[model samples]
Target: MMKMKRIALSALLSLGLTACGPMEESEPMPESMFEEQGSQALDAACTSLGTGITSHACVHSGNPADHLARTASATRVTSAPSISTKHTAYDIALPSGAEGSVTYVPATTGSYAFYRTQNVPFTVINGSTSATVPSALSQTVSSSGCLLVYVSVHDLTAGTTYIVATGPASGNAITVVPEFLDDSRTRYYRDADGDGYGSTTSIYTACTPPAGYTTQRFDCNDTVGSGASINPGATEVCGNGIDDNCDGSQC
Candidate 1:
């Protein structure tokens, strides 16, 4: 009686992706590279991921002697932290390809391992590599040095962003996109002149947010203005900034 799953965002609305905040702290992965630290037993590059992930943790704070510098804005992160969700323009990004069969379970059997940052342990793939666990699928199984994986693959291609290692401890594993789209097919992202992140526009064009501007999230750098930069096939803009994260013109 453990059949409960519904963390549906449609694996991020079928790739018309969203969410341009959070997950942008960068530079924090050294605790002697972690073989096992104290706060828990997990590491981070990204982990503990499951239920097809969308709520995983650990970006820094891997506990490098608890180094926060103890003052002065902690160095940097002033404004742009209120991230829970928001990034539209169909979040188009497909080419983080290559993944298959990854099944590992060793809760009480000891000596279980995992691999892959980008293939080559046999051309990379764990497709159907199960270790016989059908106690009705076993709550995904994870404990102590936490680890739980299950992948059977099937068209199962959604958005993309994966890099999880577990053995000496590592992190990052975000999943979803079981199919969901709309926003003229859901995809949105914009930063224009801010350049902290989110740079990519054009989802059917028409953008203009630079005149006087009361509040600016971003506007008309090109959405279909055909200004040439939104990438893909080029030549298409009504003005929402079509550079679509190609980092050219959308502001």
Candidate 2:
């Protein structure tokens, strides 16, 4: 009986040793292999990005000095209009048909406008002493209370010009700012009833209008009926209780 027990114990010990041998051999995968696979994946991803990779860096592996050098070499791009020293603003007082002169020397040839703060009727002459105003480049009053007198000056040289108020004398001051093509100025009006059209009373000037406001000032009545015809273009309904056309007369 003792010999049989010893044989069973020895068999159990051999099975345990075999299991442990396989467990020891089955070690975790090497960390280097995982790192190599990750690198390959990153490379494939960057390659798949295609043309976008050219405009952007794949990885910011550059040192601080290298980053600083690249930032220093980069140039700033701006969309704002560039005005030369030749462009200027003038506050001039003029009676009706009287003229005021200012020196304007354009650095680059482009379309320019004499933007006035008030709706002052003015005719612009190329020279200060020239009696004849150019018929082609005539002055016009904009709806935004500013006179946008456009003048196309090609290969503009340094010179002075005269701005004369054409209408009867108001004895009011006018500010003239020489604006290049595509000025950012915009005029907004009050839209009390949330209608697209705005009233002529309130005037707001900015590059962009606020909410519930519009750039058009054609609303005859902002306090008209809810969802009613407050637009000036609407047909006037005669004798109706509601002012459908907002023309102050009911049909």
Candidate 3:
């Protein structure tokens, strides 16, 4: 993982934003490379998402050496804080910052536009239009004692390519991911048992699970029935990681 300085820019600054080190383009690894790695266990759970297979949903702040949300049509995120207009650079690449779940921010309630590198066959939506926890620590740990990740309008990254949206804040009326850059993060850590991405409160310990919650899910393959499976299935509301259908949008 590469570490760079966060040369604080304008109001558009995001807590997820970080100067990522050069990616491991070293091997020019093929899609199958993931299979050789432990990702198989991860892949066994998650698959491609709506955004397209080339997408990335979850990334780590340190060295997102592993990616999971690459399959989904869109990436998930949370609003860290109220960003000022001066720093709204919704077009920056996070070193490895992808989101599995985001804080349902009220600021995201307005009509907004999203663009991405390409378009995946999926739907983008604003779930539970309300941020549950305020601070990361204050965030009630899930059943496993992991703090819930929150999303707000401010947390949305820029320049990746995503669909556009329009409507009331939480009541998004027209959320269209017009084949753009909907590359946010979704799958980073393995949560096969839907036991919080890494660790968290019990089912209650975690934030709002997805509409169809599951457990022990991974994002390496795309054929398992788990939420992280690349193949689509009955997705459990496993804390809104963005795999609503468990098809690996975060794959």
Candidate 4:
């Protein structure tokens, strides 16, 4: 019986089969392993984002509109700070140097993040109104001599225009990616004019509304002097030649 068992084991080994079970399939190689040898995660000159399957990267001339076009169309953009307008005064304080601006419009209202390969100062502003949009938080880390700077911005409204400025640093072209962040916080819009209603265009996200903001939106005219009465809760002062109630008609 022992001799017969040994013969059976030898037969299995000769057939390239394990005693416990048949041979298992080899695992597939990871996507990163397929990259060329010695290639850094992000190239030294520029960073490519979402560079797999359907997405691609491209160079953006220092035009804000072009930046908006490429990014909105799902193409990643690599751009350099404008030498001419780097010192242009933005809504927020910037480092003393050149900077470039990109116009971005979110597809949905939520939190979003901006990731850059180069460590440089960045800011977001309301494009239509030129108001400084505060960021929720920001961080910077090192990666193979590249600086990964990311800024988290909350309550970006869909269809509203926003501006992203990068700069005050010199080097090769830098890659910038705007990614949407998912969370459960409530969204609020700015009500600077003290109107009970807010502008749907300018939004913010938080556990509670920050100072000078409100949960209500859709104030057709939220400007000061007459905006205090222009809200959804106001009674229509019919035929006064103004849509005080924001119902799209004076009467």
Most accurate candidate by lDDT: 4
> Clashing residue pairs in candidate 2, if any?
96-169, 237-251, 238-250, 238-251, 239-250, 239-251, 240-251
Q: Candidate 3: which stretches are off by over 4 Å?
A: 1-87, 92-110, 120-123, 127-251
- Give the TM-scores of the predictions, in the order they appear: 0.16, 0.27, 0.16, 0.34
Tens digit of lDDT per residue, candidate 3, span 133-232? 2211111111222111222221232322222221222211111111111122232333444433321111211122333343443333332345332323
Candidate 3 overall lDDT versus native: 0.26
Q: Backbone collision count in every prediction?
A: 45, 7, 115, 2
lDDT of 1 by residue, 1-251 (tens): 22323335555665554554445556444434432322121112112222212112111112233222211111112221111121211111111332222221212211111211211211111223412222111112222332222221111111221121112112222221111111101122454443322233312111122222222223334333332254433345547634554435554
Query: How do these models rank on lDDT, best leading?
Result: 4, 2, 3, 1
In candidate 3, how many Å is residue 30 off? 61
The list of candidate 2 runs beyond 4 A from truth reads 1-89, 95-97, 118-121, 128-169, 182-251
Best by TM-score: 4
Task: Report per-prediction Cα RMSD to one decimal.
Answer: 23.8, 27.7, 23.5, 23.6
